[model samples]
Target chain A: MRVENYSFVFAVFFANVFAWNPTPQVIEEQVPQTAFAQLLDFQNAARPEYNAYLSAGIIYLPLPSQSALLTEWGTHNGFAFRQRIGIWLTDNFDGKGSKGITFGLGWFGERQGWDNEDFLFVPNRGNFSQINQIHSWGLTIADSSKHWLFGGGLQYLNAKDESFRWWLLGTWSRFSIMPNFHKGDLQFINAQLFLQARELLGNENSWQNYLPDLEFSFYTKDSVKIFVSQNIFKQKYYLEGAFWARPQDFAYAALKFYPDPSRLLLALEATATKKDNDDIYFGGGITLPFLRVAYNHADDYESFFKSRGIWIVEIRLAIGSSGDSFFALKAPKAAPKEVKRIPMKKANFNSNNGE
Target chain B: MKSVKFLFLLLLGAFFSSCTHWLIDTETRIQVKNSTNRDIYELSVISPGKRIVLVPDTLKVDESSNVHVISWVGKFKFAIFVKNLPDSVYLGEYELKGGSIKAEIKGEDMALKMVLK
Candidate 1:
């Protein structure tokens, strides 16, 4: 049933894309070259500014190892459509230093269709179900100084029907094992080691685990970044790699290109384990100034895709002071504003029943 | 210097100890205890469209099986069928509020109790 709906959505999406009058490439070409440079400069200069933002999107990712231990308790591990809304506030505490704190709150409701009867025990009529709705709030503090960066997040979750409940408290510190250096023309490498301790709060007893990870990033002068991370924590050990490239400035206004890989993102991550529970995940996204279209795929997702495969699509719009400053118009231009309203009047009517 | 070393060691020990204390009040498991004279022929978990068959198919009298009913949210229901019984003995619903939950099946009436460990 959901698959049919998804097909209709995709059809509408493509139709709207084709109907766009002046596409993104046309808009890019209208801006002057100098404006692009100014946009990058302004973005770098505003990095430390305080800002707040709100975004809505869909996400289907497994909870971390600790909370996921609920699976041992018989909680279903499956992919569900999550309609999520999130808001965040960030501020640079120190006026001049690289230290800041962020507070965030999010809520999402998830529902999945069970088409496969193999795993169903009831197999009753009209059995489409919804997973637990969750509300979460978190705070993070970070400081990057002396070749070391540290951050910690304390998150709390409340699920509907009290089926699931837990808190995730984690702290991580990163040391710059190798700073960015020029290996060749337009080539650089940066490496970091991250150590973290995550504590999981259950209704009975709490447990904590320590994780150690290494991250390496290779980038060119053209703003294309390729990065990889290797993480080994308790029940999870995975190696992930990603590539992201900056969008190009267009020279032609009339002709537009679809599926721009340069401005797109692709990632592949895998968890290594001897058990059948080993997982491989794929994520991809197309990013614009304040808009994002992303999708994630997993092999072992049980809810919607099940064994065939799972695809989660997300579309979001975000607004912030500095988030879109680089993408906003170069010069501030004002247009005439107009307002129209019709005055309201009351009317009285009389009716006779004798006739 | 000796005091500083002692404190460092104490902190390390505390950290390790906390890591081992995994089952806190937030996560819980469930168990099924049969106190009736008749044996349970089949026990199945019923949630909306899905049903899970608990293993060890038969539960003899006075026998208990550790059933993993992980509830991050709240309560769920199950059904118990006695040997050769035409109808099911429905266990309305049970919740693991803070710790482990035990569903004591006594003849026709099932009682739920929580055990905090």
Candidate 2:
């Protein structure tokens, strides 16, 4: 069998054991019970005037060596599983100008699985039986007032194996100012910066560093948004444009045909130093009641564990205490006071009837 | 022969001494649903090392009313452990009634509605 095929089979076996079966149980047992549940409910509420959300996903990458066997004895080589969770704190979480200032925290863990003979980061190329595990955490803060949205965050990562240890510190910040333009078209200017530091905290001899990233996005209308970003230091640049329809639930069958609840996105990225390495990416996806799927060319497999590229598929299954209400593709518009007041009475009436 | 041996040693040393590491960012979303007949009055997310202190450890439910009101707030601290690092964690609240749930953090408002499954 080819290397990729063997990797797929091994991946399926481990995936069945690790990713699919254990997640449901873990989620069920870990569901919170208290004000936190209320916070989650609020975050998930449709038309959340202001809200925050926290989520986690895991990605797996199998090594090529795992596909080939030695002798007749079949030995399975392990793959890398990168796990990440993020808290999306957004003021005006509903996207309506109802609230401001939201904070989020994201934490991640990446484990590199390799056999004793294949371990790479060893002193004097020594053989190490243990695998390497890395841990990282990030925090994002956004403050959105009447006309402006500003946010920033940092990430710290530490990795260790039998032979060596490494550490990295990265920082990112973004500012977006929305200016009142002519009818229906909202114009905005955005700026972003990213910086990173790498060091061998344990051995001290092995170290490297990089600092690159900046970009801007312009929201022209409800259906059109354009952005350009570049890493001035690294001389790399990218342009991206996206078109999305107004949000509508499947229940509103007639309304669906009007806006076409789908998205088309195009992006091009190139390195000034080596423009030949440039890559162009195009993707389109749909939003449905049961699942959400999207395809993208630039796959962040290393960071997100998910694939990105020519043909990528993303499938999400909505399973939580709340049903379709939890995942809002876009913020909901504000409801008038009279409309808001009715639910309070309805809740009270339900309680009374139950009694 | 001596020069060839020296070149081989240099290549081996260079390969063993150099290392590279990649930094990645991941996002996870968690959804919680309430199926019980009773209104879920409160929700809290607790990490492995954190303590939850409820001013009143218990709730008093009115025997004749199905409404549940949780009116208490306490601080909890989460400590990072090498093995217990969680990718994402969240707590949510839902009013069994057909209204929106709201959480305000740093002045941002997030509203959600509860749907009966």
lDDT of 2 by residue, A120-194 (tens): 334121121223343333343434333222222222222231211121121121222222222343323222332
CAPRI-wise, candidate 1 is incorrect
Contacts from the true interface found in each model, as a fraction, amount to: 0.00, 0.00
lDDT by residue (A186-263, candidate 1, tens digit) is: 223334344332111011111322343334333445654333333332313333443344333211111111121111
Model 2 per-residue lDDT tens digits across residues B1-117:
566557556644542232211111011121223332222222332335443321111112221212323211112221111112232123233212112222211111122232322
* Sliding window of 10 residues with minimal summed lDDT for model 1 chain A: A326-335
| TM-scores, one per candidate | 0.28, 0.28
Q: Write the per-residue lDDT of candidate 1 for residues B1-117, one digit (tens) a residue.
A: 567557556644543233212223334465677777777855655665566565345778888876664423233456677777776666665543535666567654343222322
What C-alpha lDDT values do all the predictions have? 0.34, 0.26
Interface-residue RMSD per candidate?
14.9, 18.4
Weakest lDDT window of 10 consecutive positions for candidate 2 chain A: A249-258
Model 1 global lDDT (CA atoms, 0 to 1):
0.34
